[model samples]
Target: MSRAQIEPGGCLILAGTPIGDFRDASPALRETLAEADIIAAEDTRVLRTLLQRLGVTTSARSVSYFEGNEASRTTGLMEEMLAGARVVVVTDAGMPSVSDPGYRLVAAAIEGGIRVTSVPGPSAVLTALTISGLPVNRFCFEGFLPRKAGERRRRLGALTAETRTMVFFEAPHRLADFLTDAAEIFGVDRRCAVCREITKPNEEVVRGGLGDLVSWATDHARGEITVVVQGAPARVVDIDGALARVRELVADGVRFSAAVAQVATATGMRRKDLYEQALAKREEHEDG
Candidate 1:
């Protein structure tokens, strides 16, 4: 197949390759890969295999662009884009810079006034949410949890009151621990789904509360995992209780602002409201 011509100037094309299945790649991707003057692939071997699978031929120059060398290579890639090179960047799977490399290059290209376009493809975020059996009205993508148990718990603590669905990417090895911590922080009863090897032949979605899913992930699980966690239940307004707690914490030598933050975290109240109450309590303390 003949490759479509890319216009002259700094054009940075972020092409999305399939997450698992080869057939999932789009037509535009093949043409872009063929036409790009420089192909900055996450894995050159994978790119070669992908090309073979798609029966696409490319005489374009290939270079490795991943986490280790992303910073250094970004500068050179942007320079090429500025020189009117059609530069194409592809990750081993899915869109680049979505919890992956290519962010630095994209930022540099945009900063240099280059044209950055994308051939949109599959994403695990949307795919997991679609089958999560949780509320998707409002959601946030938290790429990965901290590896250590303590740090992971702290991260989950910080997100305790988040009322939107949360998504995370986890390696198969640590998935059990991640799910266990999630159960502790988000509550054992909180609904969640573990999506594994999405778009692959053995793609599976394990749906259950956090505790149940943790057990399921313990055995016979080896693939990419995307965990979707349901958010905490919304708290009812308790202005009087919140104000009282803030006042007590302040009297106990906790700084007024710090007290307010603590109260907000405990009560799931907006920090702004708690701050106003803390200010009033401080004024009362001074006057009294």
Candidate 2:
């Protein structure tokens, strides 16, 4: 497609760079980097380092599109893609636009009818989460928390009841403070993990209660820090509440047996157990 008059606009490729080990990068990511018409990097210097590590040379014009200049640069990059140029975005590490620059450019590319795709590779959030020995079935990646202590606490406080595994990126210097505050709010006994320098030489994962991690982070926290916190424990289903619900359903003109079955299914209790309990409670009430 000619740059001057293309039928369809060029594509925006979000290239995922290895968070630590360069070898984790896919062949597609390297080729896309080498062949792109333009590459927008969160840190041009870091991109150059990665190019060296991957032993790949690229002539694509590299431009800085980080938080500070992202707003100004998105338009130019979008214009380039509009002209049938294959533009790729890479962050210092991991995928672009996750706690990094690239979202604005991607949004603009989509708005201008440019095709958007990705060369998926490594992700620190997933790396830390999996290695942290935390639950993987359900998780929520909470990118860097608020820098201010107050805001950070408020944000964490709001997630006190979260039941899914929680992951967060924190600066090495702030890891200790974050752990300490989390221990206080999430409770000292809350199980957690601190994954430091993930997938890199000297990588370390420390798992323990929040109380224990606070002390560990003070001395051992270094490199890129991703904390995988155990989510607030599942709230115990109140047996009495289930029984009361069954009564309410029966009082609403539903038959007692059906009410017991519905409440049992909803509350994860056996129908026989709930039915027996409800009958016993009714008998006790009548006798009283």
Candidate 3:
């Protein structure tokens, strides 16, 4: 195709590749691959395999664009587009920029006055969410948790009050630790679904409470794993009632710290705030 056939200022095409099943490749994806002047891929080897599987031959020059090199490679790709090349960006799976390398290129392209478009295709997030048996009306996607145990716990602790269902991508090896921390922070009884190898022949989804899932992951959690956890049950926060509960626990010989933890978990209040309030109430009673 000639320059006139491409967009006036050239175009940046973000194309979604199949998450697992190769048959899920769209015709638009094939066309974009075959006709583009340059193709930026997360993994060029994966892209070549995809092209071979789809029986599509492309004359387009392929370049590696991934997390490590994205910063340096984006400018060159943008320049190519500025020179009137139809540039297509694809990741190993799913949509580019969702949790992939295309975001930087898209931002740079826009800044450089190039037109950007997407050819939507399979998404592991949406696919897993729809079949997770959790409430889909409202949800949040947490791509991956921090590798460190302390950091992961802090992250999950911050979301303890989130009422919308949560989706998270996790590695197979860390699945047990992830679930264990999630159970401790979110509650052992919270419902969740562990969707593994989505859309592939051996796809499996294990549904249960966080505690049960933790036990199951000990031996069987393998492959690409997506965890969908049901949100915290909605509870009306009543400061007065929570303070009263704290006082009762304290009177029954519970330590101040222990009392605060119990009340916070029961009332969905921040433990630190509850502890301060309980301390103040104790001081007032002593003064009286």
Top-TM-score structure, candidate number: 1
Which candidate number has the best lDDT? 3
lDDT of candidate model 2 versus the reference: 0.85
TM-score of 3: 0.85
lDDT score, candidate 3, position 210: 96
- Which pairs, if any, clash in model 2? none
Using TM-score, rank the candidates from best to worst.
1, 3, 2
User: Higher lDDT: candidate 1 or 3?
Assistant: 3
Model 2 Cα lDDT, one tens digit per residue, 1-288 = 222122345888889999888889887877888888788898889989999989889889999989999988988888788778888899998889999998888788778878888888788898888888888999998999999999998788668768789999999999999999999988998889888888899988888999988877888888998899998776666889988988897889979987787666555577888899999987898899
Which stretches of candidate 2 lie above 4 Å from their native place? 1-9, 236-288
For model 3, residues 1-288, the per-residue Cα lDDT tens digits are 432245565799999999999999888888888888899999999999999999999899999999999999988988888888889999999999987889988888889888998889998899999999999999999899899999898778768778999999999999999999999988899999999999999999999999999989989999888899999888899998999987887789978888788778767888888888888888998999
How much lDDT does each candidate structure score?
Answer: 0.86, 0.85, 0.89
List model 1 lDDT by residue over 1-288, tens digit each: 423354566688888888998888788888888777899999999999999999989888999999999988988887787788888899989999998888898888888888888888889899999988999999999998788889887778778778899999999999989888889878999999899999999999989899988878899468888989998888786988889988897779978787788779867888997798768876887899
Estimate the overall C-alpha local distance difference test score of candidate 3: 0.89
Q: What is the lDDT of residue 35 in candidate 3?
A: 86
Q: Which residue pairs does candidate 3 place in steric collision?
A: none
